[model samples]
Target chain A: MTELTRIIELFQLPFMQRALLGGILTGLMGGMLGSFTILRQLSFFSDALGHSALLGISIGLLIGINPSVVLLPFAVCFALGVTYLLERTRLWTDALLNIIYSSSLAIAVIVLSFVGQYKGGLNNLLFGDILAVRELDLVFSGLLLIACTVFIGLTLRTQMLLTLHEPLAIARGVSVSAQRTAFIVLLSLVVGISIKAIGVLLVSAFVVIPACAARLLSRTFTNYVVLSAGLGALSAVAGMLISAAFNLPSGPSIVATQLVIFLTTMALPQLRALGHG
Target chain B: MREIVLSVEQLTVYRETYAAVQDVSFSLESGIDTAIVGPNGAGKSTLVQAILGILPRQSGDVFILGQPLSCRGSLAPAIRQQIAYLPQNFLFDRRIPMTVEELVGLGWDKLGFQLPWKDHRKRRHAIREALVRVDAAHLMHKMISGLSGGETKRVLLAYCLVRPRRLLILDEAPAGLDVRGESEFYQLLYQLKREQGWAILQISHDLDMVRRHCDRVICLNRTLLCQGTPEVALSSDNLSAAYGSEFVRYRHRH
Candidate 1:
């Protein structure tokens, strides 16, 4: 068969289409939320939340439930708890993040060990099988993307700028607490949904590296969002194409493509200025 | 006489167990430009924070346009809309991707209101006008992270002026500016006061600037030392009390 015919046949299966749609939606949301994630210096928080998803996924597998549903509430609670503890306590935010990150990974590994008989299910989650995506996952991811897009677009001016310079925003009457809560919740939702496409291990990179690369290449804030989304979408599509062609894992390929983009952008003379290089 | 826009009676601000601002009482009349002058560590910032409801007031009554200040609820959106504040220091992540225009637009974003009006032309005009007023129109498209200290101050000043608030509170607004920039900034404030009748409360350490520009002066040294026109309130004794021995040296130099 010709290359075009092979690709067409690959997508003719319902699962491939679902995975592609889900990846695109997740990438778009990741790009948008990544802008604020970088702006607010909450990259560590994203990492912590991503790792915490494993615990939720483990529980889902143990109970024989839809992993996404279990993971969403778990991620939201983890995000909110981290935010509250950081704000209300005297402990340094970075230290708290490290604790959450390491502990969650340990718990997930221990729980997964107990359920060793479900190795196949755990492996599916770890290295997301995009070709195995269900229709429900596609619908949920699509709605999430739409909701997150509208929310981010509506509050784009206030939320992004406030995250950049909070005191200045506060002086101009932006409610810092309210805006922060909304942003963290939005991020958690994005992380929860994207876990299936990028897997919990690589999802935070999907949210961070693309935005960081976009920031280097773009001059303005709006451009950053658009460019980040474009880069993320490109990486997801390219990764899926390469993975299908080589019969390799899609999740790692997508993440690897993102890293390549990040490195390439970093090496460009004009973009290099963005990193203090 | 213009009405009192702000009244503080028996105001005291404590940082932990120590009293930072003690028994400070002052009233700012509308259309008047008042300067809060004191040495560093003399609680000028603490006093302003207390009035803005950012810092807790240990014991005091703060009335904004005849209404008691409330911190429990979000500052009344209307009141907040009508008030502008310029903080002393503003820092943002350098990697943050944003422009001066986007930052200034944040001034118009209030709670419970979806900004349905996306009139880019009108918003840009307003942003331009604010930038031009602060002599920062050229920097409107510049990345906030790339601007110099003085340029950043001017941009932030433009951000504050995007909306015409009844009262403008500037904490060290001219701290990092050059002599010409500082002069032009104060001149802009004076012109705004003349044309718009906006009340200005400047927290500054530049006594000379305060003498030249302020309609009234409030000297603080953990308490209200004096309040009135600069000539009457800035007497040598009051200055001495506020700055200890520095007043004598300042007088000699002047």
Candidate 2:
């Protein structure tokens, strides 16, 4: 009946705990990798992978396999395929990405027609259900967080070298092509795993939003990465709590919180400039 | 024997079945600034790229530090690290989120190895030194995308110089610079070349600058036309030979 009692009741539920933990982990991972996603303009690629996960799911259902398990490798392959196309073809980039993700979604729909539709099985993945978060899902997200953090830490300098100037990086003896492949695989894994919690529609927002927000405030590279991850975690926890309080869906709630953060952080500097003037 | 930093022998590269570069060969001696001068589409950059093992050589071989370039396997990185390069028309994303300091740090820590506290500090010190040498110390905190054309060139030069190098390959390293910035870039390059005894190999269209600065010049028009001292290479006769009727002395700035 009371607000405090209602809040206590929410925390008392095990599923709520799992959702909170999973959301926080996924958010942090997304934020960390999102820095590179934004810088490398791989947001579109991540989005495509997100959609491609649905195609994987459709194929899994058709073959009587678990969709969640199939999503990872399928997404990785899909990203690699895109990378290969980019390297080999002179097609305009916008047309290239548009063709890839759209074809993926279209294939998914056709497969869904034969294997049955989004009634129950597909609905869960499309928009996500935070209330259905399980202990294993939490563990998977936690592992992804650790994996992303370690990869970013280890490859930070090398990836930056490759990204800043590939020819120069090559001259400096960096295997930029190899490094690029590794980065794409990691991005695919993140996008694949993220689909269960944030869904295809909102997965990229978790990535791009926190990084865009952090970009406004960070003055250095290390600070930018740290801040993005921190913002992501905060947005996750805060958004989860807000969603619980208001009985709203968790994914969009979290994205709204991040958008607000980006706007506020972006405006603060201009506001300070106004004060100075 | 005089120290040979790089030797390219009969290198040919094809782009879409047409020879972008054909039977190009030249050797760079240590402490000498060598310029490869040519007209547009002459494949000067292509030659430099092939030498660094960035592009496949259709034929012939490149020996850097007296070892042949394999362009693959474990040896490539080590060999590449020995040669510092600045690419002409470096494909830069204008919205790339990085500062001059961080980007330069990328060049300093090329292998992406996380160092201990002392080594990390030393790396930072080396980065600062490179920036200072290139006269870009003041622009260290600026966002890379926000820099002016000349400043970007200086920062890129600093980035290339962050690590130890035996051979320095520059592809139009001074493209966007003004008169003063261009001269300053050359001065900084020559000062370091003299101090470190580096083999300076560069691609340029500026015959006047090449004549003033380079010890040796290789004139190219899709292939080696002449390789000699700049006086001999950039003479009216030699320029006409490489550039054909397109070559005009008045076109070159003093």
* Highest TM-score against the true fold, candidate: 2
- Extract clashing residue pairs from model 2: none
Instruction: Encode model 2's per-residue lDDT on A64-160: one tens digit a residue.
Output: 8877788888988888899999989999766798898899899998998998665556667887777777788777778877777777787777776
iRMS of candidate 2, one decimal? 2.6
Give DockQ for candidates 1 onward, in order. Answer: 0.54, 0.54
* Model 1 error, position A241 (Å): 1.5
Model 1 spans > 4 angstroms off:
A61-66, A267-277, B108-112, B246-254
Q: Count the backbone clashes (under 3 Å) in each candidate.
A: 0, 0
Model 2 lDDT per residue over B149-168, tens place: 77887887787788888888
Measured over all alpha carbons after superposition, the RMSD of each candidate to the real structure, in angstroms, is 3.2, 2.4
Which runs of model 2 end up more than 4 angstroms from their true locations?
A117-121, A274-277, B72-76, B112-118, B245-254
